[model samples]
Structure formats: C-alpha cells, structure tokens
Target: MTGRVRGALAAAAGALGFLTRVPVGRDGDAWAAFTAAPAAAVVPGYVVGALAAVVVAAPLAVASDLPVASVAFAYVLAVYALVGVNNLDGVADCGDAMVVHGDRDRRREVLADTTTGVGALAAVSLVVAGLALGAVAVAGTAPFVAVAVVLAAEVGARVGLAALAAFGSAPHDGLGSAITEGAGVGTAVLALALAGPAVAWPLLAAGSTLAGAASGAVAVAAAGAFAGALAGTAVVGAWATRRLGGPNGDVFGAATEVARVLGLHAGVLAWTLS
Candidate 1:
C-alpha cells in the first residue's frame, strides 16, 4: 500500500515537473530516472492545475454568488494566471508572429523576445477575455468539470509535443528535450484519452438538457467539436515544425496553451448551446 501510494505521488511530481522546469532541477541527481518518467510529470501538472482551481473557485464562490458561467470564466483566468499563464504567453507570441509578419525568422524572433508587441498584446487580451467570459457564463454547475477539460487538453498537447520534441529534435539542448526523452507514444495516447472526455461529457450533458437523451445527434456535435480541437493543435504543431524545424520550449508552451483553451471552450460551448 505504501509503495503504491509513493508511486502515485511520484507520478504526480513527474507531471508537475513536466509542466514546469522545476522537476528537472529537483530530480537533478536522478537524470536517467527523471527523463524516463513521463507519466510522473503529468501527475504534477494536473495537481498544480487542481490546486489553482480551488484557489480561484473558492474565492468566487465565497465573495459573491456568481452565475456558473461567470465563475467558469473566472476559474479559467485564475488557473491560467496562477501557473499555466506561460502557455498563454505562447498563444500571444504565436498570434503576434503569425499575424504581424510573414517570414519564419521574424516569427521566431517574435516568439523568442520576451517583449510585448501590439500584436501579442491584442491576441493575449482577447483570448484571456474570451475564456473568462465563457467560464463565467456557465460556471454555476460545472466550473471544475470545465477546467478539467482544459487541463486534460493541456496534457494532450504536452504529450504530443513531447513526442515531437523527442523525434524532431535538432542539434539543440534544453528542457524540452528532457521531457521528450521521458515521454512515450503510450503516454501521449493516454493524454489524448484524458483530453477526449473534456469535450464528450459536457457535450452529452448539454445535449441531454436540450434534447432529453437523443444522443445520436449529440454524437455528431461531439465529433465535430473534437475535430476542431485536434485542428487547433495540429495548426500550432505544424507552425512549430516549420518555424523552428523542431519545437523549442517556447513552441511547446504555446501549443499546450492554445490546445487546452481551445478544447475547454469547444467543450463548454457545445454544452452551453446544446
């Protein structure tokens, strides 16, 4: 029992480590083990996300009675701001690079520079605002559930990028490679499975609300939404591949953030309108 508990805890640490650069230093001595423990990283990232949810949701719940929708939006803002905001930065950078310029070098420059440009400013603000509004509108009953969808998508994106970094590695050295070395196709698939529900369940609930169990039609809607989620990730991944010839830490961060929000929004919106 103790061993099982420890194993779970380690995996959680690994997950957290995978999300942030903290795990690499923490597990510095065990280079081989840390690099091979991909599932471990997922655990920590999820835990961190869950903790952020409590902090964000608790205050909104206590301070005032908000509509589920409002709280849902707040939760997203809080979660992103608290620990996952790095990914938000990625989205903003990607947007700025993709929109304001054409050349690959310029795009990479936009991504690498920590400075904010007009394009980056607009993209980040708009996205964060949309996420906050979406959550607030439907936060009443399923705020946490919605957040899970986001985090799950985050993990999925991470898993995919993990595979990308591992295989598409250039003559570079960074933490991204370390994570890729640790991850496997199995881990990536599991991440996708975890991410899949974020869209499907809320979709079913929303459909049930409006249609009262006509799931056949719900299946169609769910499939479309899921496809959109995939498309978002693919777009980002392709850009990263072309732009850098391989993903760097920045690209990885950007992809994860974009996919997570896209997944959450896609799921919640499907349910909200269903």
Candidate 2:
C-alpha cells in the first residue's frame, strides 16, 4: 500500500479497536506484518470519536420533537450505549484499585486480575449514567457550548492517550507504543502537524463557550478536573512502568477508557458551573 493508504488503514483499524471491544493487535500488525505506527495510529481513533459525536448529536438536534434539552440528553444516552461505559470501566478499575484501596503493587494486581470489586462496578456504572445525563442536560440547556465541551473532552482524552503511549516497554511494548513505533517519527510528526490548524475553528468555538464562564471558580473547577483526568492515566502508567516496570495492553486500554470518561464528566461539570 502507499504511505497515505497505510496510514489511513492503520488509523481506521485503531478506531475500530477504540470504539469497540475488539483488540488492537501487537504492532497493530493485523494489517501490517509487523507493528505499524501505533502512536500515530491513534489519530484515527480520535477521528472516529469526533465523528461518533457528530453523528449522534447532529441528527438528534434536528429530528426530535422533544425539547432541545431532551434531544441533547439523547445524544449522551447514545454515547453511553456507544463509547462512554468503556471509559467508565477503566476509571472504576483504576479508581477502586488505586484511588480507594491498595498500594501501587496491589492496585496493579487488582487491575490485571479478571475480577471485579464493588467499587469498580459502582464507579463505572455511576459515572456512565451520571455523565450521560449531565451531558444530555448540558446539550439541551447549553447547546453549542455543550457540543464544544464534549468535543474538547473527547479530543483531549484521545490525544492524551497517544502522548502517554509513547512511554512503553521492550518485549512487552504497550498497545499504543508498539503500534506507534511502526509508523516512525516522520509519520507522527505529520499526524500532529496538521492537527493544530484543523482544530482551530473548533477551538474558537470552544473559546466562545467558555467565554461567559469568566469566573475564577469555574476556571478552577475545570482546571482541577482536567488535572484529575490526567492523574488517573499518568499515575497508572507510571506505576506500571515504575513498579511493574512495564505497561501491558490492558493498562493501555484501561488508560484510554479512564481518560475519556473523566474528561467528559469534568468538562460537563465545569461547564455546568458557569
């Protein structure tokens, strides 16, 4: 395949993995014989998420006889069915294990073992439902602002996952790191190179959403939440690298989900305040 075709193929596979339960193979080599551009491949996943939001949100905005608010909520309701819970699971696994109980060692163990704790269940279930409802409410009440809010959260989480994925292991390279390694430095540069300008318009629109918030409290809340979202992934990644000394595919998957859910809620709550 041509270079761009390879890239697009890689991106689409990663997106399929991101949005569904299917696994992203080592090196994302399912398509390529060897691992191919894992980190850069994540761009496709972000594209998919952004597309998913637009697909679900736009139609709901137009056709529903329900109040705009109700229509907004429906978008979130679809999200929970589509992509939200996956993140919630990651959050609960990270939370119940690391945030609530257990040291780094124990948390890693808990995270890996095929077992579920009450905390994990509660955390994921609650966050999924709450975020969906909150998103719905925000979309209904706030409309364009809420769109920016969720989009930022979605885009931020995916990008954050790619950045964190760069730190991986040897024989056990991270799902992100391994697949990323396939793409090469030049590919990564190209992937991110166009991102800034592409999102410029959205950023402007997002800025408009945050404009009225003009409050220190709202800023603090949003900032704090954004920090919190990163903590879950960074902490887990660090712990895996430091203690266990490497990140596994599960950890990578866990990080992606955790980051996405946390960003959504944090954005929603922050926007709600203003």
Candidate 3:
C-alpha cells in the first residue's frame, strides 16, 4: 500500500482498538497511533460497531419464539461487549460528580473517587434502564424498522460523542482532553454527515411501506428524531461545560448514552405517532 493508504488503514485500526474491546492486532501500535489521526476518522468504527449490533438483533427480532425484552437485553449486551465498559464507568463518575454540591474541583475529586455513591448508583440505573426500554421498544417493531432504528440510534450516539468532544472544552490533560482538544467544527459536521443516512434509513423503510399518508409522518418523525439527537448532544455538552467546568471522559460517556436513548425514543415515537 501507498503511505497514504497505510496511514488510513492504521487510523481505522486505531479507531477500532481504541473504541472497542475487539482485538485488531497490535502490529501498528493502534492505541498510540490512534491519537495521531483526526478523531473524525474514528467515526467509521462507530458505524461498523452499529452495523454489528443490527446484525445481531435481526435474528432475535424476527424469531417468533423470542421475547422483545430478551432481544433488547441481548442487543444492549452486544453493544457493551463491542464498545467496552469504560464509558459506563464514566456514567457512574459523572453521576456522582453532578450530584455533589461543590465547585469544579470538588466535583472532579468526586469523579476521581473509585467508590460508587448513591448518585453513581442512580445514574447507572437510569442509563441501563433507559437503554433496555429503548431497545425493547425498537425490537417490538417490524424487523426492518427494528434494525433501522437500532442502527440509527447507535450511529447517532457516536455522532453525539464526537459532537461533545468537538464542542466542549476538556477539563484537564486527560483522555477527554486528548481526544477532543484539537477537534474542529468540521469534524462534528463530518460526523453528522455520516450519521445522516443511518438516521434517515428508518424513514426510507417507513416510506416504502404501503401505509400511504402514515409514510410521510414516519419520515417526518425520523427527521425530527435525527434533529433531536443532534440538538440534545449540544445541550448536554453545554450543560456539562457549565456544570463541571468542561467535558471529561465521564461526560462523553454520559452524553453518548443519553443520545442513543433519545434517538431510539424519537424513532419509536415517530413510528407510533405516524
């Protein structure tokens, strides 16, 4: 391969290695090389991961003997397995940090504490419950729609993560800082562009149905959901900046989890209302 091709390959591998637990081999030293590439390149890794989720969920979704809850639980497990539990740890830290009544320093201290508090407990509960409920709702839908919505929601979640990284300031010279520090608006825009089709796929699926006027409504809902996913990310990023002094790895994790749930609900609501 040419040098440029080699770099692209390495960056892609870096993205998978960094974002996921999947082994991509250590030949290229992906963890270190990952930081060298623009974070936007990692977006594709999210797409790949989301696609895997869809594939895994499809069989369960179409199976007559399977329960929706089982499918949802499996889907959630598959995603967490692929993505790693590191972000969930962030949710716990962010929760504790948010509930602590103090300035940024105090919150940061709480975030760094290894012990889980009531706040952390509540945060994990809410996040896990939300994810399960959202997955169940999507799984209850038609196979095509279920796959589309799940795919879109996962993609939107990653886009939200990238947006948070791009728009929010880093609290310190930590992982969040390293990832988000130099990310520009262009990176966010690129993430949205990649996410757009995934978000819109449900609409296309809905439109292809013979439901007439309801088709239009589903399309509109899909659009609204997509817009909401993006808007919610910005709002959360700003909130984290104000409340915590800036975004951290925890905040990014929280934002991504929030975005996925929002996207899933938006898609389901659109389908229901239509």
Candidate 4:
C-alpha cells in the first residue's frame, strides 16, 4: 500500500482501538497512533462500531418472537460494548461538569476526578435507559427497520463528534484538542456527507411501509432526518462550547451520546409523520 493508504489504515486501527475493545493489530501501535488521528479519520471507526452494533442487533431484531426489551437490551449492550465504556465515562464527566456550579476550572476538575458523582450517575442512567427505550420503540415496528435506524443513528452520533471537532475550539491540551486542531471544516463536511446515506437507507425502508407513500417519501424522510440531526449537532456544539468553554473529550462524548438518541427519535418521528 501507498504511504497515505498505510497512514489512513493505521489511523483507522488506532481510532477503533481507542473507541472499542476490538483488537486492531498485534501491537499497541494503533492506539498510540490514535492521538494523531484526525476527526475525519475517526469517522470510519464510528462506521465500524455502528456496523458492529447493527450486526449484533439485526439477529435479535429479526427474530419475530423476541421481546422488544430483549432486543433493546442486546443492541444497547453491543453498541456500548463495541465502542468501549470510556465514551460513557465522557458522558458522566460532562454531566458532572454541567451540573457543577463553578467556572471552567472547577468543571474541568470535576471532570478529571475518577469518581462518578450523583449527577454523573444520573446522566449515565438516563442516557442508557433512553437508548434502550428508543431501541425498543424502533424495533417494535420491524427488525430490519430498527437495524437501519440504529445503524444510521450511531453514525449520526459520530458525525456530531466530527462536526464538533471541526468547528469548535478546544480549551486545553487533551484527546479532543488534537482532533479539534487536526480535523478541519473539510473533514467535518466529509463526515456528514458520508453519514447521510447511512441515515437515509433505513428511513427509506421505514417510509416505504406507510400507505400512499413511496420511495419519494422515504427520500423526504431521510433528508429530513439527516438535516435535523446535523442541525442538532450544530446546536449541541454551540451550546456545549458556550457552557463548557469550548469542546473537550467530555463534551464530544456527551454530544455523540445525545446525537445518537436524537437521531433515532427524529428518524422515527419523520417516518410517523410521513
């Protein structure tokens, strides 16, 4: 392979390793190299993680006899398991930071603490429960539809992270800081562009199920969902930046988790309306 290709591959491996427990290489090189991976480079890692979730959930979803809660439980477990718990840790930190009454320094200190506070625990529980409930709702319609929506939603979450990295400024030196600097507007646009089709396909299938609506309606719904999710990401980035004094690892984590939930719900709502 060419140098660029090799570099990209290495970065992808690194991104995946950092994002999940999945073994990428024989050594720790990829994880070490992950620090330099750009926001765009990490997009593929998100795809891999999302695809893994789809694979795990698809079987459960397809089993018509399966309970909705079972499918949801299985799917959520697979997603967080594949992506690694650190992502949730970020969510917890951000939660603690959000509720804490102090300046950026105090918030940062709270975030840095390893102990999970009441606010952090509550935030994590809410997000995880929301994910499970949303999965059940989506899966109730059809397994295939649920799979597609989830696949898209996970991608949407990562896309939000990329957008944040591309557009938001990081206040301190850390994991998010490297990404913020390395990932440019071009990368953000590319991440969104790549994620659009992923979000659309599932919505297309769901929309087709509605009477009087055809593929065109699917197109409309998909477009709306994708647009809505991006808008949501922008809003999250803006709000988090203001509240947290710019994007951090915690902010990115919280944003991704939030986007995932929002994307799934928005897609389902669009389908319902159509």
Candidate 5:
C-alpha cells in the first residue's frame, strides 16, 4: 500500500481503539496518526453502529415476542458496554459547568473538578433516560427500520464528534486540542464523506423492505436523524465555545451523548409523522 493508505489504516485503527471497547491495539504512532487525520474518527462509527444495531435487533429477530422494553434496555446496555463511560464523564463535567453561575474561567474550573455535584447527577440521569426512551421508541418499529434507526443514530453521534474536531478550536492544550489542532474544513468534509455510506445503506435497505411511500418515509427519517445529530452537536459546540471558551474533551463527550439521543428521537418522530 501507498504511504497515505497505510497512514489512513493506522489512523482508523487508532480511532477504534480510542473510541470503543473493541480490541484494536493502541500505540503512540497510531494515536499521532489518528490526531493528524481527524477524518479517521468517522470510520469507527460504522463498526460501532453495526455492533450496537445487532445488539438491539438480534433479540427481536430471534424472539419476535420479546418485550420492546427489554430490547430497549439491552440497547442502552450495549451502548455503554461498547463505548464505555469515559464520554459520559464529559456529560457530567459539562453538566456541572452548565449550572455554575460564574465566569468562563470558573466554569472551566468546574469542568476539571473531580467532585460530583447535583448537576452531574441530574445531567447523567437525563441522558441515560433519554437514551432508554429513544431506544424504546426505535424498538417498537419494524425490525429493519429499528436497525436502520440505531445505525444512523450511532454513526451520526460520531459524525458530530468529527465535526467538532474539524471545525472547532480548543481553548487550551488537551484532548480537544490534540484532535482539533491539525483539523480544518478539509477534515470536516472528509469526515462527512466517510459518514455518507452509513446514511446511504439505510436508505437502500428501506427501499428494499417497504413500498414507495413507506420507503420514502424511512429515507426521510434516516436523513432527519443524521441531520439532527449534527445539529445537536453543533448546538453543544457553539454553547461550549461561548460558555467555556471553546470545545474541550468534556464538550466533545457531551456532544456525542446529546447527539445520539437527539438523533434517535428525530428519526422516530420523522417515521411516526410520515
């Protein structure tokens, strides 16, 4: 393979290792490559989304009578199991920062504080509940539709992270800076391009499984969900930029969690309306 190809492969491996509990090996070289190629972050979304989709859909497929609630519970568990609670730490940190009535520096200090506050408790609770509720709605859909929605949401969440990395500047030297320092508009475009297949595959599946109108609705739902995820993350990024000076590792994590939940709801709502 060419040097570029090898570099891209290593970057992708690094992304998977850093982002998920998947057994990809990690190293200094891989981490450096991943930071340099921000687009590589989008690649892992497909793998993570697929695995999570299967976890959500497999039970329904095997036992058609399985309760939707049970499936939803599994979906939530599968997400945490795959991605771990590291990102959720961001949610807690950001949550604490959000409630602080102080200057940006004070909020930033709160972001770095290890002490758990009521804000953290509330934020984490809401996110977890939102995720579960969204999964319940998705689980109520047709199996193919459910799978498509789950996949789209997961992938969209990662796309949100890539967007922040590509477009936002870090306020300080940390994880956010490490990823965003080398990124720019080009990185954002490439990340979006990498995410296209995740969206397209769902539309194609919808077309195969439903009649024209229904398929079109699914198409809308999937697209809406993806867009919703990006939009949700954008809101978080903008808010963080204003409130905390710029995006940080905590902001990125919070964005991911928020985007996934919003995306899931947006897809379900679109499908319901259609």
Candidate 6:
C-alpha cells in the first residue's frame, strides 16, 4: 500500500484502540498516527456500531418473545461492554463542573477532581436512563430497522467526537489538545465525509427484508439520528468553550454520551413520524 494508505490504516487502528475495548492499535506509533489525523476518529465507529448492533439484535432475532425491558438492558450492557465507562466518567466530570458556581478556573478544577459529587451521580443516572429509554424505543421496531437505528446512533456518536476534535479549542495540555491542536476545518470536513455513508447503512440493511416505505423510513431515521448527534455535540462543545475556556477530554466524552442518546431517540422519532 501507499504511504498515505498505511498512515490512514495506522490512524484507524489507533482510533479503535483509544475509543473502544478492542485489543489492537495501542502502540505508540499507532497513537501518533491517530492523533495526527482528525478524520481517523470517525473510522472506528463502524466497528463499534456493528458490534453493538449485533450484540443487541442477535438475542432479539433468536428469541422474539424477549421482554422489551430485557432487550433494553442488553442494549445498555452492549454499549458499556464495547465502549467501557471512560466516556461515562467524562459525563460525570462535565456534570460536576457545569453545576459548580464559579469562574472558569474553578470549573476546570472541578473537571479534574476525582470526587464523585451529587452532580456526577445525577448526570450518570440521566445518561444511563436515557440510553435505556432509547433502546426501549428501538425494541419496538422491526429487527432490521432496529439494527440500522442502533448502528446509526453509534456511528453518529463517533462523528460527534470527530467534529469536536476538528473545531474545538483546547485550553490546556490533555486529550482534547492532542486532537484539536492537530486538526482544522479541513479535517473536520473530511470527518464529515467519512461519516456520510452511515446515513445509507439503514437503507442497505433493510433492502432485502423491509418494504419500500419501511426502507425509506429507516433512511429518514438514520439521517435524523446523524443530524441529532451533531446537534448534541455542538451543544456540549459550545458550553465547554464558554464555561471551561475550551474543550477537554471530559467534554469530548460527555459529547459522545449525549450524542448517542439523542441520536437514538431522534432516529426512533423520525421513523415513527415517517
């Protein structure tokens, strides 16, 4: 392969390693490549989303009579299994910082503090609950449609990360700076291009099993989910920039969690309305 292709591959591997519990791409070289390319952050979503989708969908396919609550629980489990609690920690940190009534430095200190405050407890609970509710809605859909929606939501979550990495400013040396410092608007556009195919995954997945109307609805749902994910990401980025001076690792993590939940609900709503 060409040098650029090899670099892209390494970056993708690095992103996968950093973003999920997968065992590959942890080496220093892979990480270097990953941090160098902002678009790399978008590639791993396919792997993660596909894996989570299968984990949730397989049981439902095998046992169609499974309770919706059980399916929702499985969905939540699959997400934590694939992505782990690191991002959730980010949600907690951001939550604590957000509720603190102080200047930027004080809030930044809160972000760095490891103490589990009431805000952290509340934020994590709301996120977990939101994810479960989204899964409950997904369970009500056709199997293929459910798979599409789940996949779309996961990919959208990653796309949100990429968007923040490209456009967000970082005030200190940390994970956010590692990405934001190396990325620019061009990289952000590339990230969006990489994410564009996710919108079609639903239609392609449903082509053989779903009717034309259903397939179209799935398409609308996927698009809406992707849009919603970006919107959620923007909200977090804007807030972090104003309150904490810029994006940080915790901000990125919070954005991912928020984006995924919003994307899931948005997809279901679109599908229902369509």
Over the stretch 18-99, how does candidate 6's per-residue lDDT look in tens digits?
8888898999999889889968878777887777777667777787788878888887888888888999999999999989
TM-score: model 5 vs. ground truth? 0.95
Question: Per-residue lDDT tens digits of candidate 5, residues 1-274?
Answer: 9999999999998888888887783888888999998788777778877888888777877776889999999889988888899989999999999999999999999999999999999999999999999999988876666766777887888888888998798999999999999888898888888888777765665546552236666777777788878888999999998998889999998999999999999988888887
User: How many steric clashes between backbone atoms does each model show?
Assistant: 24, 10, 0, 0, 0, 0
- The C-alpha TM-scores of every prediction are 0.66, 0.64, 0.85, 0.83, 0.95, 0.95
Poorest 10 consecutive residues by lDDT, candidate 5? 204-213
Model 1 TM-score, 2 decimals:
0.66
Off by over 4 Å in 4: 25-62, 200-232
Candidate 3 lDDT by residue in tens digits, 118-232: 9999988898898789888877766555655666666666677777777778888888887776577876786777666765654555536622334455555555456556665
Q: Give the clashing residue pairs of candidate 5, or none.
A: none
Candidate 4 structure quality by residue, lDDT tens digits, 1-274: 8977787677677766665567773256664454454544345435654665465456654566777677667767777767767768878988787789988788888888888788899889988887777767665644444545566666766677777878788989987787787777876787767676665664545535533345544454444445555665677678677776788888777777777767667766765676
Taking the tens digit of each residue's C-alpha lDDT, what string does model 2 give over 172-266?
44444555455445543544453343234333334343434433333333343344445556765786676545565555556665555576566
Worst ten in a row by lDDT for model 1: 209-218
**Model 4, C-alpha of 256: deviation from truth (Å):** 1.5
Model 4 Cα shift for residue 188 (angstroms): 0.7
Question: Model 5: runs farther than 4 Å from truth?
Answer: 205-207, 210-213
RMSD to truth, every model = 5.4, 5.9, 3.1, 3.5, 1.7, 1.8
On the 0 to 100 scale, the lDDT of residue 60 in model 1 is 51
- The segments of candidate 2 whose C-alpha lies over 4 angstroms from its true place after superposition are 18-35, 41-47, 55-73, 84-89, 99-105, 168-194, 203-246, 265-274
lDDT of each: 0.55, 0.52, 0.70, 0.67, 0.85, 0.85
* lDDT tens digits by residue: candidate 1, 1-98: 69657555565555554466453334643444445655444444455445545644465546546555555655665565545567777667766776
Q: Residue 28 lDDT in model 2? A: 41
Compare candidates 3 and 4 on lDDT and give the better one.
Answer: 3
